[model samples]
Target chain A: MVTEIFFKEFHTPNNGIFLRIKDSLIKTRSKFQEIWVVETEGFGKMLLLDGKVMLTEEDEHIYHEMITHPGLSLLPEGMRVLVIGGGDGGTVREVLKHNPASVTLVEIDELVIEVSKKFFPSLAGSFNDPRVKIIIGDGVKFVKEAKDSGFDAIVIDSTDPEGPALALFSMEFYRAAKKILTQNSFIVTQSESPFYNKQFIVELLKNLKSEFRYVKNYIASVPTYPAIWSFTYASDSLELDVPPKRKISPTKYYHPNMGLDTTKEIVDEVFGCS
Target chain B: MVTEIFFKEFHTPNNGIFLRIKDSLIKTRSKFQEIWVVETEGFGKMLLLDGKVMLTEEDEHIYHEMITHPGLSLLPEGMRVLVIGGGDGGTVREVLKHNPASVTLVEIDELVIEVSKKFFPSLAGSFNDPRVKIIIGDGVKFVKEAKDSGFDAIVIDSTDPEGPALALFSMEFYRAAKKILTQNSFIVTQSESPFYNKQFIVELLKNLKSEFRYVKNYIASVPTYPAIWSFTYASDSLELDVPPKRKISPTKYYHPNMGLDTTKEIVDEVFGCS
Candidate 1:
């Protein structure tokens, strides 16, 4: 890795934005399919893969908040949680904050995890905890075995709905997801932006609604993500919302008082939930 | 103008992001320090200046919808409208959909309009309507001449708080805006994204609240914007949440049915509006 890359400011109507790509790299690694830890102005340590901003190092708060808080806070305390395809350990780190009994992260790619450990020590720290189990295997198979064992909440933090990750979004995978959860359990997945992929999100929502009794979609501002983002939460037991039961702690982007009630509002607008 | 500037793309997660800088070939004429357009995949065009994305190309529907509908819809039948700084013409386009008696668009940067006319025909076509007026001047000065002329709605579609356009976000400018409207009239401005610029939006909201009793904030999804954007709607007689009476035509966005209610909800959330 002997490459050198730099940032150039762009014309924006919002805030300071930057782009991080590989030029000539002196220090770079092949993790996941195309993962890179990017640093930007105002926002810090962002993760990028295939030139997409995966998670910002500075403001993982929004992603983590929307992902972890909505599901964990709604479930009973000390529930079992499983996260699929989160190699950066950001999802697991957020899950740990909820004080879950056992948190397992099954990531198919090992190099991504190794890269995260090397470049992102803070987020990678969650993997070192005893309560957290790191499994290197196919997430689909892992979910099958884990389904028989029983779980409370499952969050899938996978990549895009293309490439090898395509199976993650299939109906078969969702069927497995349904069987893994215990009664009164909830499942959350990162749906793409409603702007560029409204039809895609609509189809994803359709599939999810077909399986779950309760389904909801919420939007969040992920500067790195396309067309902002729509996150989907589903369950047979409880309604998903933006209103939070507990106060958020140590976050850069999410506010605890904001709650998950907003989640319900967005979902209501999605398919005319009202 | 003879020479052209080029932007380079960088790879992130699953997107191609672009950045711009001052080039010897292309000359920038704006009084602002610098301007850039960050181009990213799936997300819309992002604008940056001095290293920040102030506005992006994509996901502008949200901001444009909120800015145009509430103010125009609130007017009496056939009320005239004057839009300052909406040279890209998206706001004017939305205003035209309302089938107002007449509309005017004032923009300073002919270059921006020209660029849009070339690169973005959709926004440029917003200027194609017969009833719409296109003016080239500083909006701060243009409103003073139109006082004797009554306008049902006046929209300030300009940049953020700093530069020659800084005054546009000020009380004095709003006072001019107030003078341009008829009785029971309204105005709207592009408030920044709450996720990224809460302080800036809050400060602007405070200033507007000080001048108008009916003041509120609304949100939209812009992919390239630093954060999903929020806008401020203000009126003299009617509460901001109350839908204005109107029969606007079809729009790519802003259906009067859901549009009106969506604005109200966004206002309720951002401004603590009742």
Candidate 2:
């Protein structure tokens, strides 16, 4: 007897790596397109293009908060930030929350910006802020032209090692970053989930490890992404203005005190997996 | 610009209970049909029903390893066990690994038996044991009738509270549970996540306070479940089994040691929510 069955795979948001499994099967009209989205089902969507995960939805707070605060928060403080590939604009929004001098958001995809602005209202707020500058452009080429700039912090919110992000994962991009960043600048990017693409993440971490002494992997829960994703941070100086335990106000995400506490779990999962 | 957006609610399977959440428009492609079969854009599909979350493409051992081992490891002495609503019986298979005396499986749906025999090869092993007794009937009603029918432990593996479970979450259900067990019988059910669900869980716990002397919430990380959906254990006379500090077994879902350490966090979230 032949019957229809459901085969679902949990995957990394960055590459096509996934763990596929069966959830359920029913003989009926396919009324709904999807089954159900549970907390354990894992967040972050995986876009496998030519057998590679293109994007995983990093937790809105963990990745955005980490990418923005770690460097911007350390600036003694800076007012302006330039973001590349964060068409989602979540990182940009986190940057402006610090009351930055200004934010320049250079995104290649208008659709991503449109989607983030629509679906993720809290994240899109960064683009709407007067202090934010939304510029639709290529980050790799842009970084090269903006060398010796005085931006307080520069965040790379690109996708994984595909599309426009191919160059961002390379060292030339880091060298370009060094050219544009301030004396004690910070830089971070989506490093992908460890479960599906540990090799890719390790390679990225290794390359960054070779380039910077302060490169570190910070983890966070992304229910949608496979194995939860991590962000890689790199900088010249060790001294950073760690984000306060609490933000100036309340947030649905990013409780000030939890900022440092969540890092421990990140370290455990990372090293344990390693 | 009058660009419209959509936010859809989904009911995902977490063991038995449904983990509900509202997702925004970016999730245009459905993950799966409503039968707990998830079909995401790039990750393909997975079946998440029958209280077990196994990848459809991969073997069921991964999810089975975590779901069964964690609870069993906490109580190495468990012998006589009763599985509520496990018609497919993968859980019993995992339980049998410890070499228990007998396993009473109460499945409400008859089709589950027919389907399990045909589709699920790994799970069918649970029913093949000589010590296993299959009862095709209502778990809640049968349990109510099993007065003084002491069992070493009970695993509640029912479907979500859609229809059959309408009575499982009531005062009468727990009332019946008190009668069908020995003193040290540890009863564990799939508790909802503390994240998107605080108020709902608080109400359930509030009700349990009057029925059981001790009730504790524990969590396991399952990608299908957010932050790993929680589990609640209730006891009347004997001390609840404590979780191991380290995992003796290599499990994709749980290691033995995360218990008690995370107790405070789980308790705080459950109690603090209300």
Task: Give the TM-scores of the predictions, in the order they appear.
Answer: 0.71, 0.57
Quote the TM-score that chain A achieves in each candidate.
Answer: 0.84, 0.70
Error of 1 at A256 (Å): 7.4
DockQ of each: 0.14, 0.06
Q: Please, what are the lDDT tens digits per residue for candidate 2 over residues B1-274?
A: 3212211123233212122222211111122112234333322333444423433323244345544555555554547888887666677877787677888888776655555555565677678899999898777888888868578677877555556666777778877877787765667666666554556567677777688887765544344444435566677754444344224333443433333212233354545531
Evaluate candidate 1 and give its CAPRI docking class based on DockQ. incorrect
Candidate 2: list runs displaced more than 4 Å.
A1-83, A94-122, A127-138, A141-155, A171-188, A191-274, B1-73, B76-81, B96-104, B109-114, B126-137, B145-153, B178-186, B191-202, B209-244, B255-270
Candidate 1 shows a clash count of 58
**Tens digits of per-residue lDDT for model 1, A148-265:** 5378988989888888688888889888888888888988988876655566777788898899988766666665555557678889988864345665454444543332322223
Interface RMSD of every predicted model, in angstroms: 9.2, 10.3
Proportion of true contacts reproduced by candidate 2: 0.05
CAPRI rating of model 2:
incorrect
